[model samples]
Target chain A: MDKLLLLGDEALAQGALDAGLSGAYGYPGTPSTEIFEYVQHSKEAARRNVHRTWSANEKTAMEEALGMSYTGKRALVTMKHVGLNVAADPFMNSGITGANGGLIVAVADDPSMHSSQNEQDSRHYGRFALVPVFEPSNQQEAYNMTFDAFALSEKYKTPVIMRLVTRLSHSRAGIVRTKYLNENEIKLPDNPNQFMLLPAFARVKYKNLIEKQELLEKESENSKYNEYHDGKDRSLGIITCGLGYNYVKENHVESKCEYPILKICQYPLPRKLIQKIIDECDEILVVEDGMPVIEEWLRGYLDNCLKIKGRMDGTLPRCGELDPAKLRTALGLEPYPIKEVPTIVKGRPPELCKGCPHRDTYYALNEAMKEYGPGHVFSDIGCYTLGFLPPFNAINSCVDMGASISMAVGAADAGLFPSIAVIGDSTFGHSGMTPLLDAVNSKANIVAFILDNGIVAMTGMQDSAVTGRVEDICMGIGVEKEHIHVINPLKGHHEENVKIIKNEINYNGVSVIIPRRPCIHIAAKLRKQK
Target chain B: MKKNIILAGVGGQGILSIATIIGYAVVKVDIYLKQAEAHGMSQRGGAVESHLRISDKEIHSDLVPHGRSDMIISLEPMESLRYFPYLKPDGWLITNITPFVNIPNYPEMKHLLKEIKAHKNSIAIDGDAIAKEIGSPRSMNMVILGASAPFLGIPFNMLEDSIRAVFGRKGEDIVQKNLDALNRGRDFAEEYIKK
Candidate 1:
């Protein structure tokens, strides 16, 4: 067996490759981004001509992967937790349609909101969609489970969700790879209507999905990733889920553990093993990252007599990633005496780079909107989202991807004059086009600033889907041609850029201003490569 | 034996490169190592730290537990102090003396230096100056790595070999320059500790 030092995300990529992955689709995001990156950079993937590229957004990625699966090929889709929300449409529907070949959805969740707006657990989505979910506890498991997930997917005719937390996705460890499987030949589904979802067909598919739940649970109970260990200490039974298992092992590695432990890395509750733990011990501690989905089920659904302690109670902090220190306090041990950071150590929040084009754009936008005051600009996710911070308190709202354009339209309809929207080029391609059409249809009086950095810019400069086509897309969406203006965002052109923005703000109809420049990081990368 | 180390710096400060060299060294020695890195959004000129753990046995967690770290190797002075809770009372803090003042209200240099000196075992070396003196300004991270190598439980020569292995692809010039920077940093630390 050959060993490779790989990040958890990279391990998953290798697992997919070894599992005969035919296509890999994903939009760039933290933690999950490297999975696709590894695939794209692999010589093996290149030799195989595997379909690995960035999608416009997670929804497109999801559907594209489903398309590949329909062709009787194994496909993997990667995204962050919030990206799951964007892909939820096709994702939820895919449960009923079922997978033809193997389909694996790998979502990296941020339990502490490390680089995300929210720390959502995608495990709930797995349950909601009636799909089997696999949670790997460590790097090697991430590899093994992903390779196994494909086989599991085809066995059940369902898309398998592989849930990963930030820590698991970002950490590096040596992994021993398994034997490579052959890619599936082009063979369509035996039944022509397997993917057809007309109301009549959908109803039967839905029922089939409903009937599979019991089997999924049984599979979970028998999963290799889930194990039950008996200890002499019957007073307490510890149940750890996903990455939380590591912290418990961290605490126990030094000494012999007295409490019985049930480690769960697969979904569907594994009630058989859980029940055994409950019957043997006095109380059960449900350790999990993100939301207390399992804990809530134990208390609300089972309503067992024994005490179930977890995030719902104060036993563990309600939020954030769990570490060994937190586990120490939970197990009735005193916290380690640690030196606090001195007063001289000031807070160092993440900031925009010194030469970021968004800086020039913000400076000009702030000057142009001096009369309109604050609370007028709505921004989308990107490096530009930092506009909410000080020195340039430019943007007011940042709810979701492509929310800026529609939000600004809504504000304009509410009689707020000079309603403005700031979005990035990549984001505009993702979900902004539809909202721009909505504004164009209604002729809303607003100024939309498209910050075109010629790259995705935020997630390590992935190629933007809307490269050299921002204005063309806006025009194609029915935004007036004359009202669309492109300005180069630079300190030297700040005054003219401000003038252009002010002119657009005064326009009664929907207007778009693009501040175009290469991202600093992208420019440097290009220079270095040259 | 187990060793927990926190590698701290700004996002673009080549902190992960230090982790890479050490990782390569440990892998060759057939020891287990786990490095948890910060990526994506934080890389836009924000503070970042990589938790590097090396041991003979398995490492369970990606994070270094608070007050259990054996060393904090940092590229910036203030960034060095950011992980105080993670460092043991007697742990070493080897960091560059320069400041990366990306924030608006960075602390005064004197106060920052005073806080560094308050630590039980600390080395505030001029990594930037030594790198420049070695004629490789970009090798400042290598210098910081060299300064911390004495306390890393890894052999100095192993780290020197790692520098060559990690930088070999760039060119022989880069390898030699980085090697020079590492030795200079070690020389500085050997002299500074005599006091």
Candidate 2:
């Protein structure tokens, strides 16, 4: 077997490819973005003509994957934790519909909010959807679990959720490749209405889903990924989940910890093994990333019969990602005294790239809106979100994808004249379109600036769905043709761009201004390639 | 044997390339390796660091505990000092003297150098100048890697071989230029140690 060094995201991608993935759909996001990228760049994937492309957003990606699964093909959909929120509608409902082939939803969580708005755990979502979840401890396990997750999905006829944190998703390690499996032949669902969720059908499907929980727990208890190890000392029982197991094992290198240990990678609690640990040891410590879902459950509502220690007990810090240093302190070991970073080393926060088109656009917007004051411009996510920092300080609000346009419209309805929305090309396609339609239909007074930078510049330059179609899309949504203005965002065109923005601001109905240019980084890479 | 290294530099400066070469060498020798990298927004000219842990035995954490790192290999002077607390009391700090002046408030070069020299164990080399002299200005990262190679615990030749393997896809010219850059940097460090 050949070993290849891979990030956890790449390992999952490779695993899916080797496990006969027919299609992969996703939106570009930190930690989870690389899964689809690896498949898109894989020679094997291209040879197999696998459906690998960026979807409009996570919801569309989830629905597309479900469609593929309905055709009896294995499909993988990935997104960051917050992205799951966008896809939650289809994701939660998919449980009632059940899967036709195999469906795996790989959601990479940011426990410490690294490159994220929040650190909401995805494990809770797994429990909410009544789905079995697999959380790998290392790169090898990430690969192996992904390979097995499809079979688990097909067996239970439910989408399997594979949860990963920032550390696991971005960290690299060596993993051995497994024998490749061929693509599944296309077939239809056994029952015609398996996917139909009319209230009557949904009731029966929901009941069937409820009944599968027992078997899911049984499979989890017998899973090779979940194990119980006995130790000579019965003082402390250690229950580790996912990457928590790695940190624990890292501490006890020579002969493993002298405590009864249960390592859980497959979820739905694995009660019997956990009961064994609780029954044997004098005290129990639960180590898990994100929320203490397992820890809270083990304690139960009022049955505090045994002592349980974890995040809730201040044994570990309540927030942030876990590491060896924190674990050492939790185990009562004195930490080594490290020197402090000198005050001279100033903070270097991320900023807009020099010569970035967004900088110019923000500069012009800042100049144009000086009279209206600072509270009017609403923004969406992307590299342009950095406009809120430094000299620009241009955007007033940035609260999720597509919210800018709708929020600006609502503000305008409340008599804030010249209300403006600044959004990115990729984001405009994601959730921006529907909101724009709503504004147009209601005839809301708002000037929506679509920062059209050709590529999805923030997440390593993936293709944007609205590359050359921004203006046409505005027109299709019933915005007046004359009010849809495209201006080059550059120093040479500064005055002209500012004037255009001002003109749209004064427009009585929904207007759009597109500040268009290629992202400097992507442009340079293209120039070098040529 | 255990080696805990902090690879520091401004984002988009190819710090990961140096880590990749060393990681390849570590893997070829059957050593355990774990690297925690700063990704996403930080890659856009923000401060970036990679905590790389290598050991003959299994390693526990992806992060290097504060004050326990064996070496700080930096691509810029200020970025090197940024991880000052992580460097063990007697640990080495090898950095490129070049200043990446992307920000307006960058400290004066003379004052920065003096602050760096105040450390008990530190080496500052003009890696950009050496890379340019060797006709591979883009290989400044390789030069910094070479200057710190002697203190890496791994055999120097192993790094050279790893460099070749990592860059082999780009053809022979690139491979040779990087090799020369590495040698030039290592030679400079060897002489500085003697002095």
Candidate 3:
């Protein structure tokens, strides 16, 4: 097998393809976006005619993956940590329905908020739904475990989640190719009620889920992803989970670590192994990235007054991503003498590109809403979220994917005058359409500015679901004909656009003023393609 | 041999191209290599960095630890200063003298130049000027790559081959311009070190 240098995301994508993946689904999300992109660009996937298409939203993506799994063809659905929240409803129920085919939800969590709003560990979601979760410590394991996760999912007829963090997802390493397995033939569920979730059937499925927990625990104990390395030191037994193993190993790069180590990259706690390590060592230091999930569990599960250490006991930080330096301090290793960055280094925050349409849109909105005062323009997740930053503090809120329109609807219902929502064209297609329908149904007094930049400019310009369909989606959602307006967002059209924005805000009953312009990068891309 | 190098530049400045070329060169020698990158939100003209590790033995950490990096290669002057703490006390700092002045509070150029020059082992070459002289201003990244190529511990021909392999698809004219850019940059660095 030829060794190819690939990012961790690419490794997982290649692993899935080699393991007989029939379809790959995901909405574009940082750290997770590249997974789908790799499959889309792969010659082998293209040759095999794998179902590789970007979904409109996370929820829609999750359902389509489930549908593929229903046909007994292996499917992999991917998303970032926050995107999981959008897909939570379908994700929670997939556990009950189970999988006829191998189903793996590849979730990349951003710890330390590198490119995310929060560092939510998806393992909690895995545990909540009573499904198996696999967290890979390195790129090779990211590949190896993803390949194994499919068979594991099909073995128990359950959906499995393979979780990796920001560092691992974006990091690059060499991956050895595995044998290519043929894609599964289309085969439906054996049992008739396998997918039926009516009250009576749901109760039975829920019971089965509960009964499988012990077996899952045993599977974790035997999982090659989870290992126990005996160390000479008995004073401390270190429990390193997923990326934590890398951080801990970073400290012992030259020599082997002395502490007894339990490296866990799989779920269900692996009770027997935990017991063995705890019995041998004086105190247990649980070093897992993201939240102190393992530490919290070990503390509550074991009543044995064992001194537990981790983010909980301040051995490591409570939040943010873990790195080699953080582990060095906790391991009581001597710190590397470091030079402090010179004071002359100024902060250079990420900003809108020079010719970005969002800049012109924010400039006009800031002007139009000047008399209405600040804190009324509710915005959502996108490049437009940067409007909250300096020089263009036009947006107020950035809670989730499509919360801008809905939050504006709620605030306007509570009598906030001149309520406005600032959402990107791609975001509107994701979760903004339903909330827009709510505005139309309630006759809410609000103006939603759908900044149509022709594509999903953020996350490296993926195809936007509503690129040219923004106006039609609003029309279908019952938006008034006169209330909808589309205008160019440019320096030359600034006055005309501002007038349209002001008029819409005054119209009061659900007006959508769209500032339509192709993103600067996309325009450049089109020219190159041409 | 082991090398932990931090490549720093503004997003869209093509620091990744430099990393990619080096990545290919390291792979040519059949060595273990890992690169950690900052993507998504940070790429919007933000201060961006990449950690690249190449070793003969098995590599553990994807990230380079503080004060352990063997060299710092940057395409921007201020960006080169931004990651100075990552450079070892005896490490080399090879950076472009060009200023990508995107921020309002960009330090005074003379002061920034002084900070980079004050480093015991450093090379600040005007890569943009060299690329322009070579009649290919767009090849400035390759110029920076060439100037830092000596410190990379890879054979010169390997990087030249890497440049050819990476840019070969673009056509022979573009390839020749880049090769010229690389040679011009390496020439400038060699002359500066002698002074």
Candidate 4:
């Protein structure tokens, strides 16, 4: 077998493609974005006619994958940890409905809030949904687990969640290719009411799901990924999960730790292996990536006879990702001397690109809003979010994907005159359109600026849904044709754009001002291609 | 043998490309390689770093431990000193003397170079100038990679082969220019060491 250097996300993508994945659906997000991008660019996937397309959002992506599973085709849907929150309704119910074919929900988590609003753990979602979870420690394991995730999903008739954190997802390592599996044939469920999920069927399905827990735990206990290594010393036991195992092994380079170790990659606690370590060692230490999930479970309400040390006891820091340095401190190893950064080194925060249209848009918008006030503009996510930093301190708020429009509407309702909302074209399609319709219905006095960059622009320039059609969508949504204005956002047009913005701001009804330009990065890439 | 390196530069400065080229070369020889990259938000002109670990045996952590990095191969002088804490006391610092002054408060270039040169084991070269002199300004990353090639524990020919493989798709002209840039950088470093 040939080996290929691949990121953990790429390995998962290749593994799933080799495992007969029929469709890969996802929205562009950091860490998880490369999974879908890999499939989209794979010649093998294109040759095999595999479905690869970006969904409107995570919720739609999840539902579409479920639909594919219903048709007896293996499906893979990916999203970041927070994206699971948007798809929670379908995700939580998918376990009850069960699956006719294998389904893998791959969620990449950011432990230290890198490129995310929060560092929420995805393992909790796996537990909440009562679905088996696979958290691979390395690229090879990520590939192997994804190849096996489908079988596990089909065997248990449930959607499996493969949880990956930023370090594992973004890092690259060599992985040997595995034997490919053919695509699944279209086969319907034997039970007619399997997916109905009516009140009558819900009870029976819920009961069946509960009954399957014991078998799931049995699978976890016997899983090859969950290994219990015996050691001579029994003073302290170590339970490492996912990347935590790597940090632990990194500390013990020349020799293995004397403590009995239970390395967990499969979920459902793997109670038997955990108990074996607890019984052998006097004290247990739980090391996990995101939260103290297993640690909290091991230290339930009742006090145990054996002393347990983990995030709770401050043996490890309760928050942030685990690193080799942090693990060494936790294990009572000698600390390395810290080097101090020179005072001359200034902070270099991310800023708008040199030729970014957002800079021009912000400059014009700031000029327009000078008379009104500083706190009137609400922004949304994207490259334009960088406008909140440095010289162009233009935006007042940036909460979630499409909060700008809705927040502006709420403020307008509370009598804030000339409430301004700024959003990107991609974000408007993701979650901004419905709120714009709400403002139209309520006749709120707000000016929504859709920064039409003709691409996603933030997550490496994926196609924007609202590109070339922002005006049609706004007009169809009942915004008066006269109120919707499109202006070029450039240095030459700054004064004109500011004038147009001020005009829209003075309008009483819902008005949308679109400053249209292709993202400078995408423009440069296109020029290179040319 | 293990080589733990920190590749640092401002975002879009092509440090990841150097990592990729080394990664391709390392895997061809059946060596274990793990590279942890900075992606997403931090990539928009902010300072970025990647931890590249190559070992004959399996690697444990994707990240290199604090003060355990064998070398810091940087594309910018200021970015090179940023990861001083991660470099072992004996570790080499190979950096391009050019400054990527994206921020308004970027320190004076002479002062930055002085701070970098204060280190006991440091090699600062004008990689962009060398690449431009070789008729390919975009090969600055290749120049830095070549300058650090001696310290990488891999053979120079292997690094050249990796460069050929990575840029093979860009045509022979590109591959030849980058190879020229690499050799120029290697010559500069060898001369500096002899001095």
| Candidate 1 wrongly placed segments (more than 4 Å) | A301-306, A525-530
> What value does the lDDT take at residue A291 in candidate 3?
89
**After superposition, which runs of candidate 2 have C-alpha atoms over 4 Å from their true positions?**
A254-256, A301-306, A525-530, B108-111
Candidate 2 lDDT, tens digit per residue, B15-72? 9999899989988878888888877887888999999989987776667877789999
> What shift in Å separates residue A455 of candidate 1 from its native position after superposition?
0.7
User: What are the runs in model 3 whose C-alpha is more than 4 Å off?
Assistant: A301-306, A527-530
> Which consecutive 10 residues in model 4 chain A have the weakest lDDT in total?
A335-344
lDDT of 4 by residue, A1-530 (tens): 88999999999999999999999988888879999999999999999999998998888999999999999899999999888988999999998998778999999999997788888898998889898999999999989998788999998899999999999999999999878999999998778788999899999999999899999999999999999989899998999999999999999897678888899999887988988998888899899999999888788878465488988889999899889999999999987775667777888888899999999999999999999778999999888889999899999897788999999999999999879999999889989999999999999999999999889877887888777999999999999999999999889998888888888888899999998888987887768889
Interface RMSD of 1: 1.0
Assign candidate 2 its CAPRI class: medium
Candidate 2 clashing pairs?
A250-B60
lDDT tens digits by residue: candidate 2, A224-288:
99999999999899999888887787666655588888999998889899889998999999899
* Chain B only, TM-score of each candidate: 0.98, 0.98, 0.97, 0.98
User: How do all models score by TM-score?
Assistant: 0.98, 0.97, 0.98, 0.98
Model 3: how far is B20 from its true place, Å? 0.8
lDDT minimum window of 10 residues, candidate 3 chain A: A297-306
Please provide, for model 3 over A1-530, each residue's C-alpha lDDT reduced to its tens digit, 9 standing for 90 to 100. 87888899999999999999999999999989989999999999999999898999999999999999999999999999889999999999999999989999999999999888889999899999999999988788888887789998998999999998988999888888877899999999999889999999999999999998998999999989889999999999999888889878888987789999999988877999999999999999999889888888888855456588999878999999888888989999888877677788899999999988999999998999889899898999999899898889888899999999999999999999989999998899999999999999999999999999888877998998887788888999999889899988899999988898888888869999999888998887778889
Each model's DockQ?
A: 0.81, 0.67, 0.77, 0.81
Clashing pairs in 4: none
Residue A420 Cα positional deviation in candidate 2, in Å, after optimal superposition: 1.1
Off by over 4 Å in 4: A301-306, A525-530
Error of 2 at B108 (Å): 4.1
DockQ of 3: 0.77
